[model samples]
Structure formats: C-alpha cells, structure tokens
Target: MTQQEPAPWDPALAPADADRRLHAPAAARNRDAILSVLRSVLPPAGTVLEIASGSGEHAIHFASALPDLTFRPSDPAPEALASIAGWTTQAGATNVLPPLRLDATDSAWPGTLPPGETPAAILCINMIHIAPWAATEGLLRGAGALLPTGAPLILYGPFRRPGRPLEPGNAAFDASLRERDPAFGLRDLGEVTALAAAAGFGTPEVIEMPANNLTVVFGKQAGR
Candidate 1:
C-alpha cells in the first residue's frame, strides 16, 4: 500500500536544528501559498529542478507534499548548500535530491540531466527581480536547453512596467534595490517575454499570485 503523505504546512513536526540557516524566513511563510499553484501546474511524476533555492526551504516543503515527484534544489553559494543539506537532514525527506552547485549565469548546468530525459520542469522564484539582467538572460536560455517541448519554466516575482501604476511597496523595494546597485531593479514583463522567446520558450501565461507577485509559465519550443 502507498504511504500517505504529510501535510504541506504542518505545525506538529519535530523542531528544526538551530544551527541550520534560513536566510529567507519569508519563504517558509509563503511556501504553502506557492505549493497550491505548484500542485496544479507541476507534472504528476518527474524530476523538478529548483534554481536559486536559497536555504532549501521550498525544496523540503514541496518535496514532502509532492511525494510522487523528485525535487532537485540548486544554488551557487556554499552557505546556501549547507543550509539545504541541513534542511534535508532535518525534514527526513527522501524525495529531495542533494543540493546541486548550479549558477544560473553559467551556460552549462552542473548536475547530470537525467539520461534520455530533460528536467520535467525548471522553477525560479524571487530571483530575477534581485539579480542582474544577464542572469535573467542566462536563466531563460539555459532553461530552454534543459527542458523539452511543452515543459514549463516557472518564474515567480514582482515585475515593472512603464505605464502601469506601481504598487507603493514594490516601488520602495525597487528603489532600495537600485540604491544598492543601479543595475538591479524590478524587471519589465515585456522585456522578460522577449528574452524567453529568444531562448526558445513559447508565449508565457501570466498568473497573478498572492503578495503582489506573478507566476509566469513559459513552455519550451517544439523540437529543441
């Protein structure tokens, strides 16, 4: 008999180790909300690679909930890798793969893409808005190479537009990001769409998510 799965957001689990670092506490808070969309969008069974999986909070959370699927979480930072290992150990999650050393800026992905298989899905949440445009270009292009036709490149984050009224919080956030580095700020949706097309992803389906964010799903083009 198949074992029943644990709830995605549970209050009754044993405590996490204090030494584990979770840089984005907000990830845990928003995890359940994200998973609701993921459950609907993600394939029933296949490998899912999460890019820039800071602290591995989403890796463990989603893996636990979607036990039928395997989750591979990757980040370039060593500190993030350590946190991911810690979270995997703490959660006792079997479906989650070891944290991979992947930088979205790299042309070649680090981990072995499964034999005779592309990753069923490529996910990146809360990354492009914070990183430089080159990173965004790399992400879309690299993901294009790693996914099959119809596969999804799921991006979740805030975006900007020239004519649209900016949300007060997002405007302030964008200002802060620009202050830190003028090159970084919320990206425009139309600009991102063009990048996706150049990278071989088809038209994107934009979904409004909670907390002023959007989920954009772009499909890979037919036949490479």
Candidate 2:
C-alpha cells in the first residue's frame, strides 16, 4: 500500500497532518480507559505483541505509559506500518519497536527479535469483528503457539453475548460492518470462548468496557 492508501479495516485513519501522523479521533477518547485495564492485567516487563495496530495511536500512547514493557505493533497493510513508525518516532517512544507486516489470517507470525523469547501478552483491539472470522481463528491459533503458559491474550471490541440484548448501537455497527463485508460482523462471545478453549486457552475473563464493548482476556493453558 502507498503512503496515501488506507487499510479497509482501519476506518479511523483520517488524513495525516504536518508531522506525518495519521489521526484517529476514537483512539484519543479510548486510550486512557484501555490503558487503565492494561496496566492491571498485562504482565510486568515483557514484550507485548499488538495485532492490527492501525494508525499507531494506541502503540505510542500505551508504550509511553508502560515504559517497562516493549511494544511490538503490527498490521498487514504497508500504509498502517508506515503510520505506526511515524507516530512512534513523533512520540519519541523508545519502547515501541518497529512495526511488523502481519496478516492475522496467516498460519503464524514471524519470530520476534532475540530468538526464542516468548511474548508475555498478545493484544488485539477492535480487530477481529472488523475483519473476517478466519482472522479470529488465526489469532487464537497464533497466540496458542507464541504465548507461554499463563500468558494473556487480550481482545477488546463489541461482542454479541448469549442471553443479553444486543445494544442498538452495536446492532447498527454490526449492520454497517456486514454491509462493508458480509463476512465481517460482531462475533458471538460464546463461539469465541469455545474457539479459545479448543486452542488450549483457559476460560475467558470478560469485562464490560465503555461504548458497549468488552475486554475479553484468555490465559494460555499450561501443559498443552
């Protein structure tokens, strides 16, 4: 993708400004809240592999806040990778490493630096629902392979829960996503949990988040 191009899943990447920073208004509003949860859950002093780090806004913000942890932001699109680097440089965030070109549907992610060191956490924010179901399956499979026992795989986004009324806003959002791509829409939480279980992940700890979203954290099962 060219510098001018934007990824289809990255709806928040608006026009860039003078600093080569791509703007995402929603990132500003949600970063702090996300950070609060991350601080409490993320393992201390370890590599964090963030999937679909669009616009790199969250990378800079999270890296700046969690100075002890190294952040590896990644996306499939070239433009998104460039935007990640631009924002990381602009923020002067040393903890934020260079972005990787990672397609979630791929069988596996490229190895991180320093050889065999496993990541302490894998973070995917508002990604799977915007993409295809295959991406979600790939994410679980990759996390199962990469993360150590007890490591966290965190997913944040709107989810359709069993026995819960679908919020009107989420329903509309799901409709819009389906319109964009028939394969993309809010996922059923029960289905996601089952997939995680099959991938050797423990039961998810679900936390309701702002804007009718959820932060679902799954732990890698030991001895699998």
Candidate 3:
C-alpha cells in the first residue's frame, strides 16, 4: 500500500485538454498510512469531503478501503477532476462520488446535506501550504458551518513546529515548495491550532506520520 500502482482509470482522451500534474504516486505511497490514522479518528462510517484531491489517487485508495464510508473527492482544477473521473471509471467504485468542483478560498464551496443531515466528516489533505492564507481561513470557516457539534475536520501535511529547530528534511522540503511558488511553503502547526480553536473546534489530535508530515484531527466540540 506504500507504493501506488499506475492509476487504473486514466482515459485515452486527455481530460479536457489540460496539463496533468500527476500526484497519485506520492498520494498512493501515503494513503494507507493515512487511512490507518483515519480509522482511529473518524466515525465508523459516514460521508467525507476530501478537498484538493490531486490526481484522484487518494480518493481511489480510500474509497476502496472504506466501503462503508462514502467519499466525496473535490478539486478546483479541471484536469484533476478528469483524472478523478478516469480513476473512477477504472475502479468502478460505488463509494466515491464524481469529483466536485471546490475551492477552499471560495465563499461558496459546494456540499449538500445528506438525505436528512450534514456531512459526518470533513477531510482535507495537503491543501493549506499549497494555497494562500485565505484558503486556510475559508477552510476553517467552512468546516464550522458544515460539521455538527461533535464531528471532525482532518488535515494532513508537513508543518513547522514552533520554537523547535527545523528538521533538515522539513526545511529542505519547505525550500523546495517555496521554490515552486513563493506563496507555497510549510505552515506553522500552532497557528493552525489557533485557527481551529477560534472556529469552534476542540484541541487537535496530532499524529506523526511518514515523510515528516502529520495528521491533525480537529473535532467540533459538543456544545459550541
């Protein structure tokens, strides 16, 4: 599960003639480890919204692993959406819905109430550092609106730990990300915690994962 196979559902026709930024390989390598952590943090079964589902790799893997849970994969980019559809076509996965056009910074990110209720979970992975600060704030604000009193908002990514010497690996990774785009770099974990707290989420449960990244679980408190 650590290594992702060639995506099973890439179509011959380019997904709307767009440049493809392949991210599934890395996502494949990390999906299982992430799922292991998710099992402990999430409700036994529910709908999950995965923001920024690049290359559609994680959506495929997670949908296969958690059949009881329906996964909603979303991305702002059209090419990514195509790749997700291609993957879905190949896997014939009933648990994963068609890719949703979603952007974290947008005030109206699309999501629907279930047959009679809101989403059971909101899952975002590797999004904050790649986008601007506004996206991060919007993600928190949107999470507060979508989840119930005791649901969870799960985020996974590499982050800087305040007051600690930077791990060489993380520092180098940060440098590489910034090189790609100055606005993209490692974010501070403490700041994320503060943002979550302000948005009515409880203290985050942080778990160390592969690649020096982490899984931070923020649950909506019971009475806020």
Best by lDDT: 2
TM-score of 2: 0.92
Q: Indicate the worst ten consecutive residues by lDDT in candidate 1.
A: 1-10
Model 1 residue pairs with clashes: none
Q: Give me candidate 3's TM-score against the actual structure.
A: 0.86
Q: Which regions of candidate 3 are displaced past 4 Å? A: 1-23, 110-117
Each prediction's whole-model lDDT (CA) = 0.79, 0.84, 0.78
Residues 1-224, model 2: lDDT tens digits: 10111123353437766665677776776788889999989999989999989889998999999999999999987778888989988888899989888998987564533477578999998899888999999999888888889999999888899998788778888888899899999999999999998888999999877788789999999986
Give residue 147's error in model 1 in angstroms.
0.1
Task: Tell me the deviation in Å of residue 67 in model 1.
Answer: 0.7
Q: Show the colliding residue pairs in model 2.
A: none
Winner on lDDT (2 vs 3): 2
What RMSD, rounded to one decimal, does every model reach? 7.4, 5.1, 4.7
lDDT of 1 at 188: 95
Worst 10 residues of 3 by lDDT: 1-10
The per-candidate count of clashes, in order, stands at 0, 0, 1
